[model samples]
Target: MTVTQILAAPAAHTAGTAGPVRGRRRALRRALWGAQILIAAFLLFASALPKFAGQADAVETFTRIGWGQWFRYVTGTVEAAGAIGLVVPRLAGFAATALIGLLGGAVLTHLLVLDAAWALFPAALAAVCALVGWDRRAETRDLLRSVAGLPRR
Candidate 1:
Protein backbone atom coordinates (compact mmCIF):
# COMPACT_ATOMS: atom_id res chain seq x y z
CA MET A 1 0.00 0.00 0.00
CA THR A 2 1.05 3.58 -0.57
CA VAL A 3 2.46 5.44 2.50
CA THR A 4 -0.48 7.90 2.52
CA GLN A 5 -3.06 5.07 2.30
CA ILE A 6 -1.31 3.14 5.14
CA LEU A 7 -1.32 6.24 7.35
CA ALA A 8 -4.99 6.94 6.62
CA ALA A 9 -6.12 3.34 7.24
CA PRO A 10 -5.70 3.45 11.03
CA ALA A 11 -7.48 6.78 11.29
CA ALA A 12 -10.38 5.50 9.20
CA HIS A 13 -10.59 2.35 11.28
CA THR A 14 -10.50 4.35 14.51
CA ALA A 15 -13.22 6.71 13.26
CA GLY A 16 -15.38 3.78 12.21
CA THR A 17 -15.03 2.13 15.66
CA ALA A 18 -15.61 5.34 17.60
CA GLY A 19 -19.32 5.53 16.77
CA PRO A 20 -20.09 2.07 18.11
CA VAL A 21 -17.97 2.66 21.19
CA ARG A 22 -19.77 5.90 21.95
CA GLY A 23 -23.16 4.29 21.40
CA ARG A 24 -22.34 1.42 23.74
CA ARG A 25 -21.17 3.80 26.44
CA ARG A 26 -24.37 5.80 26.10
CA ALA A 27 -26.50 2.67 26.35
CA LEU A 28 -24.62 1.48 29.43
CA ARG A 29 -25.06 4.87 31.10
CA ARG A 30 -28.80 4.82 30.47
CA ALA A 31 -29.10 1.31 31.88
CA LEU A 32 -27.25 2.29 35.04
CA TRP A 33 -29.51 5.32 35.51
CA GLY A 34 -32.56 3.15 35.07
CA ALA A 35 -31.34 0.74 37.72
CA GLN A 36 -30.54 3.59 40.07
CA ILE A 37 -34.05 5.02 39.72
CA LEU A 38 -35.74 1.73 40.41
CA ILE A 39 -33.62 0.99 43.44
CA ALA A 40 -34.10 4.49 44.80
CA ALA A 41 -37.84 4.16 44.47
CA PHE A 42 -37.82 0.87 46.30
CA LEU A 43 -35.74 2.31 49.12
CA LEU A 44 -38.03 5.30 49.47
CA PHE A 45 -41.43 3.68 49.14
CA ALA A 46 -40.91 0.18 50.47
CA SER A 47 -38.18 0.59 53.06
CA ALA A 48 -37.97 4.16 54.30
CA LEU A 49 -41.63 5.09 54.24
CA PRO A 50 -42.71 2.18 56.37
CA LYS A 51 -40.24 3.15 59.06
CA PHE A 52 -41.20 6.81 58.94
CA ALA A 53 -44.88 5.97 59.13
CA GLY A 54 -44.35 3.55 62.01
CA GLN A 55 -45.85 0.68 60.12
CA ALA A 56 -46.58 -2.38 62.20
CA ASP A 57 -44.00 -4.65 60.59
CA ALA A 58 -41.30 -1.99 60.70
CA VAL A 59 -41.98 -1.31 64.38
CA GLU A 60 -41.94 -4.98 65.17
CA THR A 61 -38.70 -5.52 63.32
CA PHE A 62 -36.97 -2.59 65.03
CA THR A 63 -38.37 -3.72 68.35
CA ARG A 64 -36.74 -7.06 67.75
CA ILE A 65 -33.47 -5.29 66.92
CA GLY A 66 -33.62 -3.79 70.45
CA TRP A 67 -32.53 -0.39 69.18
CA GLY A 68 -35.79 1.40 70.04
CA GLN A 69 -38.17 3.29 67.74
CA TRP A 70 -35.66 6.17 67.55
CA PHE A 71 -33.22 4.04 65.69
CA ARG A 72 -35.94 3.28 63.16
CA TYR A 73 -36.31 6.96 62.44
CA VAL A 74 -32.58 7.35 62.00
CA THR A 75 -32.40 4.45 59.60
CA GLY A 76 -35.37 5.77 57.66
CA THR A 77 -33.77 9.18 57.32
CA VAL A 78 -30.53 7.74 56.03
CA GLU A 79 -32.33 5.61 53.49
CA ALA A 80 -34.39 8.54 52.31
CA ALA A 81 -31.31 10.74 51.95
CA GLY A 82 -29.47 8.07 50.07
CA ALA A 83 -32.41 7.57 47.76
CA ILE A 84 -32.43 11.26 46.97
CA GLY A 85 -28.69 11.28 46.44
CA LEU A 86 -28.78 8.43 43.95
CA VAL A 87 -30.62 10.59 41.42
CA VAL A 88 -28.32 13.58 41.81
CA PRO A 89 -25.53 13.32 39.25
CA ARG A 90 -22.86 14.84 41.49
CA LEU A 91 -23.81 12.79 44.54
CA ALA A 92 -24.71 9.46 42.92
CA GLY A 93 -21.33 7.79 43.50
CA PHE A 94 -21.03 8.93 47.10
CA ALA A 95 -24.59 7.90 47.77
CA ALA A 96 -24.05 4.48 46.25
CA THR A 97 -20.92 3.97 48.35
CA ALA A 98 -22.82 4.97 51.50
CA LEU A 99 -25.70 2.69 50.58
CA ILE A 100 -23.32 -0.23 50.14
CA GLY A 101 -22.19 0.18 53.74
CA LEU A 102 -25.76 0.58 54.94
CA LEU A 103 -26.86 -2.44 52.96
CA GLY A 104 -23.94 -4.46 54.26
CA GLY A 105 -25.14 -3.72 57.78
CA ALA A 106 -28.60 -4.73 56.69
CA VAL A 107 -27.35 -8.04 55.33
CA LEU A 108 -25.62 -8.76 58.64
CA THR A 109 -28.70 -7.80 60.61
CA HIS A 110 -30.87 -10.08 58.54
CA LEU A 111 -28.45 -12.98 58.91
CA LEU A 112 -27.97 -12.45 62.63
CA VAL A 113 -31.14 -10.85 64.00
CA LEU A 114 -33.76 -11.38 61.33
CA ASP A 115 -34.50 -14.17 58.86
CA ALA A 116 -31.50 -15.32 56.87
CA ALA A 117 -33.59 -15.23 53.73
CA TRP A 118 -34.17 -11.52 54.12
CA ALA A 119 -30.46 -10.84 53.61
CA LEU A 120 -30.73 -11.57 49.92
CA PHE A 121 -32.56 -8.33 49.10
CA PRO A 122 -29.99 -6.06 50.68
CA ALA A 123 -27.18 -8.11 49.23
CA ALA A 124 -28.59 -7.59 45.76
CA LEU A 125 -28.99 -3.90 46.39
CA ALA A 126 -25.40 -3.69 47.57
CA ALA A 127 -24.19 -5.30 44.37
CA VAL A 128 -25.99 -2.67 42.29
CA CYS A 129 -24.56 0.08 44.46
CA ALA A 130 -21.11 -1.41 43.98
CA LEU A 131 -21.60 -1.21 40.21
CA VAL A 132 -22.57 2.46 40.41
CA GLY A 133 -19.69 3.20 42.74
CA TRP A 134 -17.21 1.51 40.42
CA ASP A 135 -18.56 3.36 37.40
CA ARG A 136 -18.29 6.70 39.20
CA ARG A 137 -15.04 6.18 41.05
CA ALA A 138 -13.37 9.10 39.30
CA GLU A 139 -16.16 11.43 40.38
CA THR A 140 -16.06 10.08 43.91
CA ARG A 141 -12.32 10.70 44.06
CA ASP A 142 -12.78 14.24 42.80
CA LEU A 143 -15.46 14.90 45.41
CA LEU A 144 -13.32 13.58 48.23
CA ARG A 145 -10.39 15.64 47.07
CA SER A 146 -12.53 18.78 47.03
CA VAL A 147 -13.78 18.01 50.53
CA ALA A 148 -10.23 17.54 51.72
CA GLY A 149 -9.07 20.82 50.13
CA LEU A 150 -6.77 18.95 47.80
CA PRO A 151 -6.55 19.87 44.13
CA ARG A 152 -7.85 17.43 41.56
CA ARG A 153 -5.42 14.72 40.60
Candidate 2:
Protein backbone atom coordinates (compact mmCIF):
# COMPACT_ATOMS: atom_id res chain seq x y z
CA MET A 1 0.00 0.00 0.00
CA THR A 2 1.01 3.60 -0.47
CA VAL A 3 2.44 5.44 2.57
CA THR A 4 -0.63 7.69 2.71
CA GLN A 5 -3.10 4.79 2.48
CA ILE A 6 -1.24 2.81 5.20
CA LEU A 7 -1.37 5.72 7.68
CA ALA A 8 -5.05 6.36 6.88
CA ALA A 9 -6.12 2.74 7.54
CA PRO A 10 -6.23 2.98 11.39
CA ALA A 11 -8.08 6.27 11.27
CA ALA A 12 -10.61 4.76 8.89
CA HIS A 13 -11.02 1.75 11.14
CA THR A 14 -11.48 3.95 14.23
CA ALA A 15 -14.03 6.12 12.50
CA GLY A 16 -16.00 3.05 11.44
CA THR A 17 -15.97 1.66 15.00
CA ALA A 18 -16.81 4.96 16.71
CA GLY A 19 -20.50 4.80 15.94
CA PRO A 20 -21.04 1.44 17.64
CA VAL A 21 -18.96 2.45 20.65
CA ARG A 22 -20.91 5.66 21.05
CA GLY A 23 -24.21 3.80 20.75
CA ARG A 24 -23.19 1.27 23.41
CA ARG A 25 -22.13 4.02 25.78
CA ARG A 26 -25.45 5.77 25.31
CA ALA A 27 -27.37 2.56 26.01
CA LEU A 28 -25.36 1.91 29.16
CA ARG A 29 -25.98 5.43 30.40
CA ARG A 30 -29.70 5.02 29.81
CA ALA A 31 -29.75 1.78 31.75
CA LEU A 32 -27.99 3.39 34.66
CA TRP A 33 -30.46 6.24 34.67
CA GLY A 34 -33.34 3.79 34.65
CA ALA A 35 -31.97 2.00 37.68
CA GLN A 36 -31.43 5.28 39.51
CA ILE A 37 -34.99 6.39 38.82
CA LEU A 38 -36.48 3.16 40.02
CA ILE A 39 -34.46 3.24 43.23
CA ALA A 40 -35.39 6.86 43.83
CA ALA A 41 -39.05 6.11 43.30
CA PHE A 42 -38.97 3.22 45.73
CA LEU A 43 -37.21 5.28 48.37
CA LEU A 44 -39.63 8.16 47.99
CA PHE A 45 -42.90 6.34 47.81
CA ALA A 46 -42.42 3.10 49.67
CA SER A 47 -39.95 4.04 52.36
CA ALA A 48 -39.74 7.77 53.05
CA LEU A 49 -43.36 8.58 52.51
CA PRO A 50 -44.58 6.04 55.02
CA LYS A 51 -42.30 7.41 57.69
CA PHE A 52 -43.23 10.95 56.91
CA ALA A 53 -46.92 10.18 56.95
CA GLY A 54 -46.66 8.39 60.29
CA GLN A 55 -47.74 5.11 58.90
CA ALA A 56 -48.42 2.38 61.47
CA ASP A 57 -45.65 0.02 60.38
CA ALA A 58 -43.05 2.78 60.23
CA VAL A 59 -44.05 4.02 63.66
CA GLU A 60 -43.89 0.53 65.07
CA THR A 61 -40.49 -0.14 63.54
CA PHE A 62 -39.05 3.10 64.85
CA THR A 63 -40.55 2.41 68.24
CA ARG A 64 -38.90 -0.99 68.25
CA ILE A 65 -35.57 0.61 67.35
CA GLY A 66 -35.87 2.62 70.60
CA TRP A 67 -34.69 5.87 69.02
CA GLY A 68 -38.07 7.60 69.43
CA GLN A 69 -40.31 8.97 66.71
CA TRP A 70 -38.08 11.97 66.02
CA PHE A 71 -35.40 9.67 64.66
CA ARG A 72 -37.95 8.38 62.23
CA TYR A 73 -38.45 11.86 60.85
CA VAL A 74 -34.73 12.35 60.47
CA THR A 75 -34.34 9.06 58.64
CA GLY A 76 -37.27 9.88 56.39
CA THR A 77 -35.85 13.28 55.53
CA VAL A 78 -32.46 11.82 54.66
CA GLU A 79 -34.04 9.18 52.47
CA ALA A 80 -36.13 11.77 50.69
CA ALA A 81 -33.11 13.95 50.09
CA GLY A 82 -31.11 11.03 48.79
CA ALA A 83 -33.95 10.06 46.49
CA ILE A 84 -34.06 13.54 45.05
CA GLY A 85 -30.30 13.67 44.73
CA LEU A 86 -30.20 10.47 42.72
CA VAL A 87 -32.15 12.22 39.96
CA VAL A 88 -29.78 15.19 39.85
CA PRO A 89 -27.03 14.74 37.26
CA ARG A 90 -24.27 16.53 39.16
CA LEU A 91 -25.16 15.07 42.58
CA ALA A 92 -26.05 11.51 41.67
CA GLY A 93 -22.72 10.00 42.65
CA PHE A 94 -22.54 11.77 45.98
CA ALA A 95 -26.13 10.83 46.66
CA ALA A 96 -25.46 7.22 45.82
CA THR A 97 -22.44 7.17 48.12
CA ALA A 98 -24.52 8.68 50.91
CA LEU A 99 -27.27 6.14 50.31
CA ILE A 100 -24.74 3.37 50.57
CA GLY A 101 -23.83 4.57 54.03
CA LEU A 102 -27.45 4.88 55.02
CA LEU A 103 -28.22 1.44 53.65
CA GLY A 104 -25.27 0.02 55.50
CA GLY A 105 -26.78 1.28 58.71
CA ALA A 106 -30.12 -0.18 57.71
CA VAL A 107 -28.54 -3.54 57.01
CA LEU A 108 -26.89 -3.55 60.41
CA THR A 109 -30.09 -2.51 62.14
CA HIS A 110 -31.98 -5.27 60.41
CA LEU A 111 -29.42 -7.85 61.36
CA LEU A 112 -29.04 -6.74 64.99
CA VAL A 113 -32.38 -5.20 65.94
CA LEU A 114 -34.78 -6.44 63.31
CA ASP A 115 -35.14 -9.56 61.17
CA ALA A 116 -31.88 -10.92 59.80
CA ALA A 117 -33.43 -11.86 56.50
CA TRP A 118 -34.75 -8.34 56.11
CA ALA A 119 -31.15 -7.14 55.86
CA LEU A 120 -31.09 -8.42 52.31
CA PHE A 121 -33.20 -5.53 51.01
CA PRO A 122 -30.87 -2.85 52.23
CA ALA A 123 -27.87 -4.91 51.15
CA ALA A 124 -29.27 -5.08 47.65
CA LEU A 125 -29.91 -1.35 47.63
CA ALA A 126 -26.36 -0.71 48.78
CA ALA A 127 -25.01 -2.85 45.95
CA VAL A 128 -26.89 -0.81 43.35
CA CYS A 129 -25.76 2.41 45.00
CA ALA A 130 -22.18 1.16 44.84
CA LEU A 131 -22.54 0.62 41.12
CA VAL A 132 -23.88 4.14 40.63
CA GLY A 133 -21.17 5.64 42.79
CA TRP A 134 -18.41 3.85 40.88
CA ASP A 135 -19.83 4.86 37.53
CA ARG A 136 -19.90 8.52 38.59
CA ARG A 137 -16.61 8.61 40.48
CA ALA A 138 -15.31 11.41 38.25
CA GLU A 139 -18.22 13.66 39.14
CA THR A 140 -17.92 12.77 42.81
CA ARG A 141 -14.24 13.69 42.75
CA ASP A 142 -15.03 16.98 41.07
CA LEU A 143 -17.68 17.68 43.69
CA LEU A 144 -15.27 16.97 46.53
CA ARG A 145 -12.63 19.16 44.93
CA SER A 146 -15.07 22.04 44.60
CA VAL A 147 -16.14 21.58 48.19
CA ALA A 148 -12.50 21.78 49.26
CA GLY A 149 -11.94 24.95 47.16
CA LEU A 150 -9.72 23.11 44.69
CA PRO A 151 -10.13 23.36 40.92
CA ARG A 152 -11.73 20.41 39.18
CA ARG A 153 -9.65 18.39 36.75
User: Could you tell me every candidate's TM-score relative to the true structure?
Assistant: 0.85, 0.84
Clashes of 2: 0
Q: lDDT by residue for model 2 over 51-140, one digit each (tens)?
A: 999999999999999999999999999999999999999999999999999999999999999999999999999988887787677788
Q: Show where candidate 2 strays beyond 4 Å.
A: 1-21
Pairs clashing within candidate 1: none
Estimate, for each residue in 19-106, the C-alpha lDDT of model 1 and write its tens digit. 6544555555688899999999999999999999999999999999998999999999999999999999888989999999999999
The 10-residue segment with the lowest total lDDT in model 1: 3-12
Q: Model 2: what TM-score?
A: 0.84
Q: What ranges in model 1 sit over 4 Å off?
A: 1-17
Q: Number of clashes in every candidate structure?
A: 0, 0
* Candidate 1, lDDT over the whole model: 0.86
Model 2 scores a C-alpha lDDT of 0.86
lDDT of 2 at 20: 54
